[model samples]
Target: SIEGYGIHGNSAEWSIGTSASLGCFRLHNKDIQKLFSLVPVGTPVQIVYQTVRGGIDLNNNTAWLEVYPDIYQWSNPELESAKVIQSLGWIYEPHWQALGNLLQAKKPLRVEIPRVIKIEGESLDIDGFYWQQQVYLSQKCLEVLTVNFKTLRADELFSGFVKLDTTDLPGGNSQYFWDPQANTLRIIRLKVLLNGMELSDAASWSSDHRLLMNIKTIAAQLNAKFDWDCVSKAAICNEMKLVGEPRDGVFWVELEGLQRVWPQLKSTWDGKNYTLELMYKKR
Candidate 1:
C-alpha cells in the first residue's frame, strides 16, 4: 500500500526530487495518477543510475568529462574506475600530450589567424637607394615584393670579375665561388660585368622562375661568403644564418631571410615597383 496508490484523501500531499519513503518508490500525486492512467497492469519497469558523464561540443571545440559524488553508500572500486574511464573516453592521447607540452612551454594557444598583410609603401628601397627594376607583390613570392637583381646593376655597387666554381649534385651541380684574396665570396651571374667589363654572353637563372638570379649568386657577387649547411638546413652568410630548404629541386629562401641576415640591406615597395638599397654602413 503506497500513499499515492489511490485517489485523493484529506491527508494527501506531494513530495519529489528526493527519497521521501522508507520501503516504497514514491512520486507526486499527479505524476502517480498520470502513470496509472498511461501504464497497464503487469508492465515492466527498469531503473538506471549514473556516477559519471561526458559530452563533446565540436562547434565550440570544447569537451568535458565529470565525475559525481556517490550519493548512495555503494563504493565498489571496479564500478568507480569503470565510470571514470567511460567518462574519459571523449579525450585522446595526442590531445593530452599536446596540451601537456603547451603547458610546459608556458605559451598561450593561438586559434585565430591574420586576415590582412599591410605594406609600408611601394618601391623596394635599401636605405635611400632604390633599384631600377619594378618590385611586384604576390603570395607566390618568398617575400612580399620580388625584384630583378639586374635592377641593382650599377658601377658604384659592383665591379671586377669574381670566379665561380661548380660541382655536380643529384639533380644538378653544386655551384659557388669565393674571392681567393678575401674571406668573403662575391656572387655574380649573367648581365653582371666581370672585371668591370662584360666578359661573356652566358647568364645564370634561379629555379623559382621569379627572382632574376639565385640569391646565392647575388650573395657571392656582394662579397658575402655564402654556403649551404646540410645539418641545419639553412644558408650561412658570414655570421648570419638564413633559413633555407630545397623544394622540388629548387633551394628556397625567403627574401625576409636575406633581409634578416643583411642588416645593411633595405627595401620598400611602391604600388608598382620595388626599391632596394645596400647601405654599407649602419644608419
Candidate 2:
C-alpha cells in the first residue's frame, strides 16, 4: 500500500515531466484506478537499489553501494591544536629570545658565553642559552638581546642591522623590550661645537663601560648622529680672532667672531654691537 504521499502530478517535482520514480513503477491517475482493483491483497513487491549511473539486480543478488557525503579530507596543520607555538610572546621579545631554551617542556638547558654579563649585581641563571649582550651597562635588568642558537664564536660586532641567515633587522629594534637595565639612556644632538667631553657624555660610552662588569646587563644599545656649527653661508672673511682654552670640560664658544657671535645684537642695540673672529683646533 502507498501509505505516504510524495511530490505528485506533472509539477516540477516530476523528473523529465514523467514518472517520479526512484526506478519504482509510477501510475497515472487512470492507471492507478484500474490497478487498485486488480491487485491481490498478498502480492509481494520488491525494490532494487542503484547508484547515480549503475543499477543493482535484486534478483541476481549484488553487493551494496558506497555513497559517501564527500570525497576529500580537509585538514589544516598550522591551526592544529598541537602545532601552534606556545608562549610565543615570551620567546620573541628582545630580552627573551635567548631564553627560548628555558621554555622547553622538558629539562632546562645550560647556556654559557665566552664572557657573561648582568645588570647591577644580579647574576643570570646557571642554566640557559646565551642571550645577546646588553650594550647599555647601567641597565639593571637582563634584556633578551641575542640567542646564539647556532653558536657563532668567531665574531661579535653589530651595526645598523643584524644578519639572520637570509633577512636583515634594524640594529636595536624589537617589540618585546622589558628594560632589565634600569638606567635611562641618552642620545646625542647637534650643536655649534662637538667637543669630545660632551660627545662622550651623550654617546654610548657610559653604557659600554657599565656593560663590561655586569654579567646580564639589560639596556639596549643604540647609535645615532650629532651635528655642530651649522651655517647657511658658504664663504667667510673676518678679523679680530678671540681665543679661549680651559683645562677640562668642553672649552669652545657657541659662535666665534664678535660679528658672528652676536650678529643679531646690532638690530637690538644703539649700534654698540661688536664682531670678533676666532678659530678652534680641538683645544
Candidate 3:
C-alpha cells in the first residue's frame, strides 16, 4: 500500500475537484464519514481519470459534454472529446469550427444537437443520451424496451454493440453489435474483460453510467508490469516512466504509457486536431 495518500475529509471545498491536494482525495467531512462506515476494510479501490466528462443535464434531460483543462498537457482535448463521443456510438459530424472557437475563447459554452433514437429499425419517440459507451434512456423508453421487447432490463440496457472476445464470457456465447449510423444500442449480453480475463465484478459504476476499472488489474491482465515509486511519485510500467500525482492514495498516470504496450493504438495529428484509432490484427 502507498503511504501518505488516502481519501479523507478536507475543509477546502473550493479545491475539491481541482488538483490541489497533496496526495489524497478529499471529500466533505459528512460524506467521508458516511463512506467510511459503509465500505469494508481491505476493499480494492481504483481511480480512473478522463479529461472529457459526459452526462445528461438532469434539468433538461439533454446530453452534454465537458472538456476539462489539460493541466498535465498530456492529451489533446478535441481528440479526447471526439473519442468520448465515438465511444457513445454516436455518428454525427462534429462542429469543428464552433468547437475550435470555444476552445480558443476559453469560455463556458453549451451546444445542443438534435438527436433521434432509432432501435431495431423502429424509431422511438424518446429522448436519450450516450455516455461512456452506454445509453441513458428516459423512464418511458426504459419501460417500453423492457416491457415490450422482453429482452433488456432496466439494468441490462446498454449500447447495442460491444467489441470483446466471447471466450471471456460465461457459457462462451454472446452477441453484441455497435452501429453508430444505425442508432442502436442494446446490450444483449455483456462481460467486461482485459486480455481475456474477466473483470466484470471488480468494475465500478459511476453516477453518470461510466464503468471504472482498476489500472493495476488492467496492467497485470495485459502482461505488463506496474509499479509506483513512492519517493518520486512516478508510475513505471514496462520501462515507460510517467510522473504521477496522488488522488486518494493512488497514483494517476497519463495515457501515453498505453501506446507503449498496445502497439495497435495509433494517434496522428494533421496540423489541426489529433485523431486516435485502435487497430486490430486479423486472426
Give the number of the best model, judged by TM-score.
3
Pick the winner on TM-score between candidates 1 and 2: 1
Q: List TM-scores for all candidates, in order.
A: 0.26, 0.16, 0.35
Instruction: Report lDDT (Cα) of residue 66, candidate 2.
Output: 21
Please give the TM-score that candidate 3 achieves against the real structure: 0.35
The candidate scoring highest on lDDT is: 3
lDDT order, best first, reads 3, 1, 2
Worst 10 residues of 3 by lDDT: 165-174
Q: What is the lDDT of candidate 2?
A: 0.25
Clashes of each: 25, 30, 5
Which parts of model 1 have CA positions greater than 4 angstroms off? 2-15, 54-68, 76-283
How close to the true structure is residue 113 of candidate 3, measured as C-alpha lDDT? 30
Sorted on TM-score, highest at the top, how do the candidates line up? 3, 1, 2
Model 3 per-residue lDDT at 132: 35
The global C-alpha lDDT for each of the candidates, from Candidate 1 onward, is: 0.37, 0.25, 0.48
Q: Taking the tens digit of each residue's C-alpha lDDT, what string does model 3 give over 4-43?
A: 5788887787888777987788998999899999997567
> For candidate 2, lDDT tens digit of each residue in 103-133?
2222222221111222221232221211333
lDDT of 1 by residue, 111-193 (tens): 11111112233232211111111111222222322223232222322122111121210111111232222222222222333
Q: Candidate 2's error at 216, in angstroms?
A: 44
